[model samples]
Target chain A: AQSVTQLDSQVPVFEEAPVELRCNYSSSVSVYLFWYVQYPNQGLQLLLKYLSGSTLVKGINGFEAEFNKSQTSFHLRKPSVHISDTAEYFCAVSVLHNQGGKLIFGQGTELSVKP
Target chain B: GAGVSQSPRYKVAKRGQDVALRCDPISGHVSLFWYQQALGQGPEFLTYFQNEAQLDKSGLPSDRFFAERPEGSVSTLKIQRTQQEDSAVYLCASSLAQGRTEAFFGQGTRLTVV
Candidate 1:
């Protein structure tokens, strides 16, 4: 019923450069959006979440994403990234159900920052 | 515990063998979740538990997969007759409440079926 699409399978950027990871979702009803980051051999950590708030959401590590309803997009952006920012990013959606909300995730985008 | 913890950081099983993955959620967490992450793919929800009750299990890929949170604090996902397709990282997560709460994740157990 609900699905997420991440346009970029991988993104390579130089250190101190700006980067954006694109995400789009298709849902029939209202949804909650989130971005998660996973470093090598570690669990996923929440970067940001868009519940019922402003379109622009700021997250950890100077990352931000704007929820565009019309475009069905929630693209993650960073003004300047460092070498440590290399990780896999995922876009996920959750809709309230009778039991509870379950997360449906997109195919992740691997962000590679080079010196 | 400070965060969700999963046991058997790595497991190697021969094809057709059975395997069991364990999860220890944060104490007092009301919600626990199980997910499967394949190579180069995001984690996929496998099941959900509220306390000791299994509220949702629709995401399980097959009947061979079984899960239980008998006491609510600890949960286990058992796979019978493991196959190569079942090789993946099994993640365990916990949340303080049922809805709209942040879910904390574990490092995950990497299962490899040969």
Candidate 2:
């Protein structure tokens, strides 16, 4: 079985400040990792995904995450954040070759960017 | 049509009442998925369908929960004898293919069982 763990339940940062949302996963086999953002009353949107290739993945809204296999982590980072960046972020993993491609998600981290 | 869409943005059902939630995936999407999101929790997988065939339903919580995608384009999740614990946001997602593709999600239907 695969599982995701988000270290922080909530993160508060001032506008233009850098932020990092930490995520760790436990899986017996290789997996695909993803970060998703959800704004109030809206559906979740993919922020970034790490399938293959480079370990560092960049996404929309100036967000980026680095997949560290040794650490079993995929932490999302933003050099600078805006008030509009406040949303709920989720870390997810999918086992490779799984027929359904079902995603296992973490508890989620609430990112609050205040001006 | 342009994106995944779920009907009844909000639903209130009395305890013991049955409810049905609808999802319309993007046109021509080959894979559809259903998920349940509880308050302050991440969404959990409920079921998966591929072109009118239900390929996986292991995530369904109980037999009271039923889902179907008959034509593959549209799907429905039915809950029998709703309970307070059943209150949650039901989300529908679709992808162009089954594996390694990005899944697009709908706004979701908020179901409240009183």
Candidate 3:
């Protein structure tokens, strides 16, 4: 079983300011990490995923995340944020495919970018 | 040609009413999933389907919750005796079943139990 923890429930940032959303996870076996973003009245969109090889993963929309094995963390970061970036974000984890792997998700963080 | 699609994007059901949410996954996608998201919370896994077989349903909260993917292309989630607690966004996702592949999500059905 795998679980994800999102440290913050809400984050407020001024437009063009850098922002970071913290996520931590617990799992006994090798796992996959992901970040998804949801705008108002929309479904989740994949931001990025950490599969293997690289610890620093770049995603769409200029967002990126780093997988720190020592910390068991995958923190999402963006150097500059836009008002359009205001949305809810979730961190998810799943055990590498052995059987039918199901994704476990975090509580989600609502990002508010103000102009 | 498309992504995951869900129908009846909004549903209003009275207490004790039965409701069914539908999902049409991307063609050729072999894995489908259902999740429930309360306001301000992340999606909680409800069930998973690998083709026509329901591979896992341990996350379903109650007996009233039921899901099926008989043909493997489309799936439905049925809620019986709808309660206020069931008032939430029911999301559907699809994947290729490959290792670490991203899951595509639908707009979700907003179920409001009045």
lDDT of each: 0.94, 0.94, 0.92
**Model 3 ranges off by over 4 Å:** none
Runs off by more than 4 Å, candidate 2: none
Residue B79, candidate 3: alpha-carbon lDDT: 96
Q: Calculate DockQ per candidate and list them.
A: 0.76, 0.77, 0.70
What does the lDDT read for residue B51 in candidate 1? 91
Score candidate 1 by lDDT. 0.94
Q: In candidate 3 chain B, what residue range of length 10 has the lowest lDDT sum? A: B94-103
| Candidate 3 local lDDT, B1-114, one digit each (tens) | 499999899999999999999999999999898999999888998999999999889989999999999998999999999999999999999999844677999999999999
For model 3, residues A87-113, the per-residue Cα lDDT tens digits are 999999987565465778999999999
Each candidate's number of clashing pairs is: 0, 0, 0
Interface root mean square deviation per prediction: 1.2, 1.2, 1.5
Candidate 2 RMSD to the real structure: 0.8
C-alpha root-mean-square deviation, candidate 1? 0.9
Model 2, B1-114: lDDT tens digits are 688899999999999999999999999999899999999999999999989999889989999999998887899999999999999999999999865899999999999999
Clash pairs, candidate 2, are none
